[model samples]
Target: MRENREIAHTFDTLADLLEIEGANPFRVRAYRNAARVVDSISQNVAMMVREGRDLSQYPGIGKDLAGKIRTVSETGTLPLLEEVEKRVPRALSELTQIEGLGPRRVKALHESLQVNSLEDLEKAVDQGRVRELPGFGARTEELVRNGLKRLRGTQGRTLIADAEETAVHLERFLSGLQGVKQVTVAGSYRRRRETVGDLDVLVTCRPGVPVGKWFTSFESVETILSQGETRSSVRLRSGLQVDLRVVPEISYGAALHYFTGSKAHNIAIRKLGMARGLRINEYGVFSGDQRIAGRTEAEVFAAVDLPFIEPELREDRGEVDAARNGRLPELIRIEDIRGDLHAHTNATDGRSGLESMVDAARERGYEYLAITDHSQAVTVAKGLDVERLRKQLQAIDRLQEQYDDIRILKGSEVDILEDGRLDLPDEILRELDITVCSVHSRFNLPEAQQTERILRAMDNPHFRILGHPSGRLLNKRDPYPMDLERIITGAVERGRFLEVNAQPDRLDLTDTACQLAKEKGAKLAISTDAHSDSGLAGIRFGIGQARRGWLEKQDVINTRPLPELLKLLRNT
Candidate 1:
């Protein structure tokens, strides 16, 4: 799976490099979409290849992509990736990650100034060479320099989705090894953080089991940094570090709790233990010379006189006190969601059609699904104009007649224009069952203006929900400047909902923001903003974010049944 992810990354990099090289736009999009499909699917890419399955049968996978997937599965590298890297150096591809530097700018920096690496980029900026490049000004150069500085501070962390996929792959691989008894992934990865620095895996095995050799034998292991009798560290080909610890069964629980910690949370718990006349560590909980608790995480918590706290809530953010008071939140789960309110189709930028999206949602047991394609403002998405949207509404109406179990809601993800106007006319918006408005461009607005824009947009009588309220794409870009508190407060006042967009890359209305909205008595909708059927599965990621924010089913608007949901919307 790590190899699959690595290959997907190669395709993504190739796409970026191709775009910079002035390749066909469609060709670049094919690679980008293929990367998302490869990364998001649940099936194992390697297993599919080993079983002689046709990879092209998967969505977004054509003959060329299937061949690349097969090649990576078999040989663990893609020749095309190598060929592409020869044209665009890896360091230059990395430069695109800096917020202000797109591929074209990266290419300009590379060719015009011979700035191929971050070091080279810095030197060129210092020498004022970047400012002199075509299409680049002094301000842009400064932004690039600042983006580089920010990148350096947060370089090694991997997205939670990527780390989770790798962790599952490693866990399965290790469990298949001889004498392996129990395997658990601990650390920020286990806590379900948005990003993780590395993985900490705890394992217990039969006596004298040769686990160290198995750790180094993983196909994705690029290099073994260290190997010892009880512990080993390896770096995966994806540049993710993994530490494996072989613990005794007796101490496994204690070690799991200790390793699966926010440092601050663990310190607080340790202080609690000390006050109780107990010594706690990774080994076990002790009261003098006798071991008291270490057999399970529950036991460790019992020893500290606290209820078991969920990992996502173990951030020392009132969770300790909540646990002491028996008030830990019964976190929201995927099953609690009854429907998805924000989805797209081929009528817009989405890869699938309305029927397919609804079928996927129905299969997931959703009582209803919204077909919220983009409206006119987002030209790149081929967003719907007035007549086209009317036709789509009719199409959804026709599709709804064929379905007895799942209801289809006619919706539009209408763009909130630069001046706070909706992309669609009031009559068109009024025709829809629900309207999900979002900001698409002019992301550089000042905080006051951005907040005002959103506030004014929410003031529209047709607005039902604010989509991806923060305009954030994790790792790729920071959220546009806005006063979220004011925006959320406006939502509460307007009887509107905020979205926790569950796309793996854009878990907007971040956990803290979700909590703020909840605290302010503003409802939230955990929508996938799904572009494909597979994307419908992203709701689980949204659920994770909701749980971390202390949101329960009652706090999520989509958890209501159709009748109740409709009533709530109408009343609001």
Candidate 2:
């Protein structure tokens, strides 16, 4: 069965390749739109195919696209993609992966420098050839070089979302096995880490059941590295490694606890057990040859006189003490969020238009949605100029009149220039309901300079949230040099806020940073920075980061109702 993400990726790559080939703009857009639809649909594409439903019924998907989707679902391959691959080298498609290199920039590079591969592009940059390009300057060249280095550093691991999708499919398949009783995906997947190295799946089955054999039957399994009666390991076509183990029902919970661990957390638990003359392992807990607790995670915790800890908090970060003292934070949940403050529209780089974005926010049950499109500094996004922003604000004012259920606020994700000035004028910024200032350029500034630059931006009374404060992309770029602690402290003193950007690629304000914000009594907003309505789903990743940071509902600014949230925003 084809995963939704895999099919979506195929479509996205096809669209990018077509764009590089200078295909029709409408044709390229059709594939891109279809990719978004496939990626964001609530249900699995495999399930839809299995049920024989019409995939063309979905937005942007036509009969031809539907047939291609069916082919991918049934055959695990798309013929069009195969045909396209023959003409376009895989390296050319990959060139577009670098940050700031859109299809147009990529096309420019290929045409000007004959750089079809990462190595070729890197050599060109080393020779000082990229900086001389028409659109790409010294800054863009440096950014691309850094992006390539980061990509190489984190090549094999998959995003947590991708791993979870695989786990969901595999778990469903195993649950359907005749003799299997329970299927639990342990390891980092269960803990909701931002990136997962591998998956460890624990299954409980009736005696004499051959569950391990059934596991290898998964269609996505690319190669069986090892197989045994009780255990098996395989690599999926997506390059994710998966291991399956069959545990006795009595030890299922213990196995889950043992495998779903940060080694440090597990060591702490083992030490705590040792102090009490209790032996703990993947088997049942033991006290002087007597089995005590192992059937449930709560039971395992209770055996050591500790409270059950959420998987997200299983990182030995004072969680042990918190659990022991019954002081574990009640982490924020997805339902606690009341609105999204930083979102975009087709007026900028966002794929969807204003009305469509608002409708998507409505679907999420948001009490408020802010149109925080990029400001004038970010030309690549066609960031809004003064006149365009005024028109957008007026349009937002009009849209607000039509919907009494949700408040639509006019906002801009304005840029924080290198000189510590905001991209949009304070006069225009104050007119909006809120202003989200971010650093779009000069990410390589020194620590002291960067800190001062942001502090000066925060000096503006209109500036509310600091968007993706560190400017780091997970597995793609290290955060720019800045004293984050001082910055967080400054935010508190100035009544400014930090954002936990929800985009998977940019889960900035890491878990530790979120906790720091909470400790300083500065609120944080978990925004999708969504470029499309479908991008709203990225909020889950943000919530995961928040929970891991031990954030509670009150710690997040958006958790409050509209009126209260508005008051908070105003005061801050």
Candidate 3:
């Protein structure tokens, strides 16, 4: 590690600890100084450790700082992490993710105003107390309000979807650089969280021209927070910050694994590394007194006696055991899905006509796609009545004829009204290709009532697919209170498919629920419920959630071919 990178990391870690313990500046600076020592060392820290050098021997790392380094090296975590967690509300870090808030303001608010949680902050703004604080005014308060509003309705915390595109763009750009051998987008974004705070990119480039030439070429840079030989930080045009670090090609994979983290997952792996007499960090892998492997992720894991983990499974959710035991679920793959069984058209609230949607589905090589427009009750979605639905079915028949390879299954996304009944009449439901059922309204029911309502709706002979069973939008909204286990079990017994909605905003029957449903013998369906032709791409999100939940091809009902799906539909 270069001295500068080490210093930067120390500052980064200090930032967390400072925020956690409300530590005053100087104490935090000690840790920052130690981080600088590690980051800036031209000689490997592993080599230093091998020489039996005590970190205490290094300046800036006093007895206390040395202890932290020892803990970090041995545990892959700070021993004080839990203590820090206790001192500060874990959510203070989250509050920082809101636009326009930083550590200084967060500390000021916490100390002076007792605003620690997002809810508390929201309340403070609503009560007009925040605008009264030093360095804050009505404009800042408005930004805070908008920040809360933007963050409030998310399904989970992650880099924005648009940020992902930016990351891909950066990856391609850096990879194309003359001196670059490899580049990767890492951090929380790689883990697919619903929102992100910043971007981390690792670059491995050939040794030749200095980093300055490469760094200067980025004209989109808003501000260069820092620039050095091995690492740099810059604010981008989109108001997002990007930090790039250059490493040797040999360490690219290990560096990526080290940086791409959920923190918890990395800590667990580090523990594993320690138990095996190995040290793991962004610098790569080391056995006591020896450099082992740092060339690839496979090599790093092999050094630790584990299989390489996929990015999606890096959520610290029992992946280690799954890898150790070789029972990682065969996870649903994109190709296994042969058709989309729920959709809508301009005949309802959808933007495209039936013909265009079916044509798009055919273009994707789907053998069958359902045109399940909204039923009459969902007026906001322009839901249709039986008479209009009859005309929509005729259009489906014509589209099916127009494209022989694509079969448009007549269907309707019937609303499960407040009283536990389908909005469409039984005759209309029976007339459709498939009757997909869901409760889009009445989310305020008690858990028991919600469970009963859904069970009763699933019992309808016409009901085939249960969409987004919990009606959650990840971080944005809480799931409608319901007894999930009972709902899944009853659906299993009744032989109805639980939908794994692919919409990014609503990957409901979340991976956890889908896993449970599969465990309970309930079948699962991956439906895009695409209201527009472009929205059809949402299946990709569903597949990601399914993979996270350990779903396999056989666990998903929609993975079946057209004939098999038709057989199941007819049986329903």
Task: Please report, as a residue range, the 10-residue window in candidate 1 with the lowest summed lDDT.
Answer: 1-10
Error of 2 at 181 (Å): 2.5
Per residue, candidate 3 scores C-alpha lDDT tens digits across 401-514 of 766777778888899998889998888778876878989897768889999999999889988989888896644456789999988888878888889887666778776677
Our tally of clashes for model 2 stands at: 0
Root-mean-square deviation of Cα positions for candidate 3 versus the true structure, in angstroms? 17.6
Model 1 per-residue lDDT tens digits across residues 1-572: 44557767777888888887778999999989888777766777788888899888876788988888788778877787788778778777788988779887887887888887899998998898888988999989887877877788768988887887889889999999889999999999888788899999999999988898889889889899999879999998889999999999888889999999989999999999999999889998999979899978889999988988888888888999999998888888889899999999989888888898999998999999999999988898999999999999999889989999998988999999989989999988888889899999988899999999999999899999999998988777778999999899899999999999988778888989988898899999999999888889888888888888999889999999999998877765
Ranking of all candidate structures by their lDDT, best first: 2, 1, 3
Sliding window of 10 residues with minimal summed lDDT for model 3: 1-10
Please identify model 2 stretches exceeding 4 Å from their true place.
16-30, 49-64, 99-148
Q: Against the hidden reference, what TM-scores do the models get? A: 0.96, 0.90, 0.72
What are the C-alpha RMSDs, in order, of all predicted structures?
A: 1.8, 3.1, 17.6
The whole-model C-alpha lDDT of candidate 2 against the native structure comes to 0.88
What is the per-residue lDDT of model 2 for residues 319-356, given as tens digits with 9 covering 90 to 100? 99988888999999999999998999989888788998
**CA lDDT, every model vs. true structure:** 0.88, 0.88, 0.75
Top candidate (TM-score): 1
Best of the candidates, lDDT:
2
